[model samples]
Target: MKTGIAHLPLHGGKAPSWLFQRMKRLAREITIAVVSEYGPQEMLRRLSDPFWFQAFGCVLGFDWHSSGVTTTTCGALKEGMKGLEVELGLFIAGGKGGTSRKTPSEIIRAGGHLSCDPEKLVYASRMSAKVDSSAVQDGYQLYHHAFIFTKSGDWAVVQQGMNDASKYARRYHWLGSRVANFVVEPHQAICCDSRGDTLNMVAVASEEARQSAVILSQLKPGVLVGEIKKIQHLHLPSRHHVDIRDIHPDRLYKIFVKTYEQAPENFESLLGMEGVGPKTIRALALISEIVYGKSPSFHDPVRYSFAHGGKDGHPYPVDREVYDRTIEIFRNALRQAKVGNNEKVDA
Candidate 1:
């Protein structure tokens, strides 16, 4: 089934201390309920589901339709899961900004504790980030990444990126079970507000373009730059907003030089190279389309609301006291469930 998506307006400011503490407590209780009822894997699957993830954030008193939901929820989960990792058999690694860069090491550490293959987990962590940042060109620069894994190595990824120009955030979801090809149609769901033109290299429709990009990468730097120059010098109608001027010749030249030196064996290797980024990928895809007759997917992959939205009144103003009451209810229910009494769980 196609997972549901959400469009969230970007908002700023940290979640207040009181609210965040309660959110952590509530998140922990709900996670306990879920794991107790279903299982750890089920909890991971639900977190990887965009709709359910958003709802989970809302239930914890976060903004229902703001970018903060992604960061705040993941932060809470990371904190709440600390003491439960061994019992629940799941671990959360990485987070916003610099913490995200530490994911591979974190995964390796967790893998060591679980006796799973650390190399494989590290690779998964890196590739998942690369796929979203490079393969999916949705204009959102990813700033947050969260990797969740079970002791058996079953994993899910939930990350968010922001586009300052549009003032919106996009969330990407991935499940290990659902991923057949990391290069194509790998996301379980991508949620964002805006949908327009995007150079989606990961789209199923872009297979030919991807192949052509690999072939183009094998060419000499001079030859590749020559072709780019041809497009750069072209004068088209006013309606054509695509300007080769936007393509940095120096950056492309550098990428081509690196590609020639490294001689990457495949698309994955090319993407894994240190200097390759969204712009580099886009240029290669564009060149493939113009020079090789293979067109990349231009369809923006954004597949598709708030409790009391946020504290600053985004979707709606956050009700502090009511939010506290909601957390209290979950706390009580969790306590009852722990003692073998679930009759009050719904009350």
Candidate 2:
């Protein structure tokens, strides 16, 4: 599956239709091969690994550096498994843009065939998105999310966010086996071209700040706004990560009222509050640091290959004959292979 990953186009979104059909068939066969050899859980493990996932897109004939790799690869995978989910015992839900928003409903639809509870899967999907977009503010707004899960309840997330100013895409990865908390240092890896100052409320060092924000949420709306204004006119220290985003007093008061009535018990709950978002989270973190003197961590949480190992390419379009031939070879091999070999059948 080695490829010319270095010559990939960074922004070339989606493979053409004729190629995508072949991609889906190849993706499906690959999944079958992996699941046949190592089992569904192992398949989940591979998808969660950033290196392997990127390599998978490359083998499927996608440009390595393209931001669309995240969305397009996930799309191919989801489409590939259409009616064989129960037989394969693996499932993929969610995709780019509005498709990402339909993840919960899709998971629920697949619930009837799963042994694991669907609600838990739905919550993990939402919390992962929440943490990346709001809890860890790296200035990239998430537009693509892919959730991969097995019948046993294990799951993994592949999500990407777009930075309008820098025009760069950052990807986040999560493995359920590695996560003990949805809101605290939960990502297994994040991939980006370069590191930048990020307001990371989910960092371990930000624990005190998180606690302080929850406690502050209990205050009256007017009282909270009063504390917020003290820092409104002041500039935040460069070394410090606490700073508010663009927010108006009236809007803040409304969110304050909701949190006041609900009284979130912890940082995760505070983040899950209906009206809470990146701006509001920044405001809370800012207030916690300035008014309450508890600073959140300014650490960026990316851990892996620098920018997914993709170099600029010279438009070397994929050869259809070779691509189609590759698919047929795999299709034939899988058709002839005995899926559950060396068990009762072999004996």
Candidate 3:
């Protein structure tokens, strides 16, 4: 699978309903074809591929270069999979905004029906979200998460985060089979147009810093808070992006108490502790840099790419006649092949 971080412009509004309906049908048909020929795990592999996923969004008739492609295409797939998930042995949960938060419950519900371990899947879903948001702070706040899994427990994730300052979005892909370690360079590769200031604690080079962070967090709350207060008085490099609010002693003490009690064995465990967000991680990383002389990677992990335009007509408006004809051809082929859902797809 081709893997890389992707950058795209933010398109306003939603996909037109007429286009979305056809997208739903065509999306479902293509999914059925993939699952029948390659099985659900291979389908997961494909979804975990950024190139294939972007092409999929294009084929679904969404704006290929916009961030909407991720959310809208995922929405199309999830909407299309509605009735066939059980039969197809594939389940897609979570979506943009509020739907993203419901991923755990949805995973449990699917697992209850399928008999595979739900907790593992839930952990995968939650950790993937947490890693991209906190472990790798690349100026994007994640607002969309789509988790796709098979009945056999194979899984993949396609989540997007947006940088409001730049009006650009970054996409992250995860194939459970590809990720052996969540904290150390989980992505197969990191590519972007430009490297901005980012706190990439997940980078292998940050191993020492991560260890120091864990050790520092285990310090008594009072002692840790005292150290943080001292850092506030020192002048950190501007690129470090430290904020007074991030290391406020009162709040830091509370968070320190939790980590101190937990005594996390590793950085991954410390990261998963409750209330450990970007701010807390950032402060710890800065402290590690100042005191331990081990700074986290500040390289942004994103790549730039261009694709076909959208319904709004950047390059050209979507050709409805051709799009419809393509769907019809696939539906007819599936129908002739006697697939159970061919008739529904043809509709």
The candidate, 2 or 3, that scores higher on lDDT is 3
Question: What would the per-residue lDDT of candidate 2 be over residues 148-240, giving only the tens digit for each residue?
Answer: 888878888888888777767777777887778877777555544467778999888999999999998888999878867767778877786
TM-score of candidate 3 versus the correct structure, residues matched by position: 0.92
lDDT of 1 by residue, 123-229 (tens): 77778788878877767789999988888887888888888988887787877767676787775555655675567788889899888888888889988888887
Q: What TM-score, to 2 decimals, does candidate 2 have?
A: 0.90
* lDDT tens digits, residue span 241-339, model 3: 546554577877788889989899999899888899987888788778878899887766554122334577746777778778878877677776674
Q: Give the runs in model 1 whose Cα sits over 4 Å from its true position.
A: 1-5, 188-193, 235-243, 304-310, 313-332, 335-339, 345-347
- Structure candidate 2, residue pairs in collision: 7-313
Clashes, model 2: 1
The alpha-carbon lDDT assigned to residue 272 of candidate 2 equals 85
Q: Which prediction has the highest TM-score against the true structure?
A: 3
Clashes of each: 1, 1, 4
The TM-score, computed over Cα atoms with residue i paired to residue i, of candidate 1 is 0.88
Off by over 4 Å in 3: 238-246, 303-309, 338-347
CA lDDT for candidate 1? 0.79
